[model samples]
Target: MVAEAQNLKVSVWRGTGETGEFETFDVPSRESQTVLDVVSWIQQQADPTLTYRFACRVGMCGSCAMMVNGIPRWTCRTHVKKVSENNTLRIEPLRNMPVIKDLVADMDPFFDKWVSAEALHHPTSTRNDAITPVDATTPERQAADAGIECINCGICYAACDTVAGNPDYLGPAALQRAWTLLNDAKDGGRIAILDAVSGSGGCHNCHSMGSCTRYCPNELDPMSAIAGLKRETFRHALRRKRDA
Candidate 1:
């Protein structure tokens, strides 16, 4: 199908530091067009000074996540045809993050939360041990695979209401990462990682809104990953109590 290219009334957020507004522009829309394409058109034709962030135009990098029409979405995949109601688009930076510029959000806290959740892998098995292989289709790997495709895009973090309410909350991405590591048979940091995320602003804070799952471009279920965390933490806590 030859998609029609219509004129779109676009609104791009401008400026930062407590002063910003949606500057309107006339953008050309086309068939199979994405929100990123619209923003790129504006940057190319309407205003060269408009600042936004995007690395890979594809959905892998997760750097193109933003607030599109009041919802967090990966601009690379969000089709304007589906989201635009009246040939109008409102683009803004992701929520709950510091705006470095117009549509660019600071992601320092997002990365820091991964560390806070102890999401990193530590070696447990020695090289001298017999080599072990993992079956990809096994229930354990499948469970870990549920949330394994995260590009660290922070869409889940920004969309999460719990993260907005509590600045210290580890958020879905971090918690999901922690869950994956916890399930990894080779990871030595499982116990410590669980302890880290079991504290204040951890998995317990998740409200089960599933905003992370809803907003995930990769379709990973973060809520399920978090639920797994809660279960594991509770089980481990009880085991410790029994030993005490």
Candidate 2:
């Protein structure tokens, strides 16, 4: 809770199709104020037409992620005092994405790259096959477990410098998911995933800026996952050469 109530000067982006402008609002501060709360107040009181997206205000869902003061974060958990300065804030949609409206960025491109990276697991056996139990203590499981908590909020993607520069780059989340599936004992698509990530705009293009890991809301290390992909892809190339 704030020591005293004061009006916060907030600058919010309002536009469509990658083109937009900022609208300033003076919102009354409250106890334990959150950025999402300010946005909600603006929509419900100051301007009913304000556009934004949010679900599960407790931060379980990543839908409320946005750029606050030039950094991507989950607005539901971002306290206004933490990110704001002098009772002022500049809010916008997540970067490296097409703006759908005032605060909604089109996420289709991010998800599409995820598919292209073969992030989904391919089961080695059908349901008819007997259940194959996995040993959680194994090194493979440990590696895979490290990255399975990703919620696809696209925060890492928005923080990726490569994705910001090259539209074709696979980004961090997709590669991290692929690395997780590759380490899964029952997945059968290791080779396919490796091949997919080794192609153009794949893991090789990653500049290792570390922003993905630095900005991940869940504290997942996407940069390490990408590094693992690089090592495994190299090993795959060597095996192919040896076989040939």
TM-score of 1: 0.94
Count of steric clashes across candidates, in order = 0, 0
TM-score to true structure, per model: 0.94, 0.97
The residue-by-residue lDDT of candidate 2 on 1-244, one tens digit each, is 6546679999999988867799999998888889999999999999999999999998777899999999999999999989998999999999999998999999999999999999987988888998778899998899999999998899999988899899899999999999999999988999899999999989999989999999898999999999999999999899999999
Q: Write down the worst ten-residue block by lDDT for model 1.
A: 1-10
Give the alpha-carbon lDDT of every model: 0.89, 0.93
lDDT of 2: 0.93
lDDT of 1 at 134: 68
Which stretches in model 2 have alpha-carbon errors above 4 Å?
A: 1-3
- Displacement of residue 67 (Cα, Å) in model 2 is 0.3
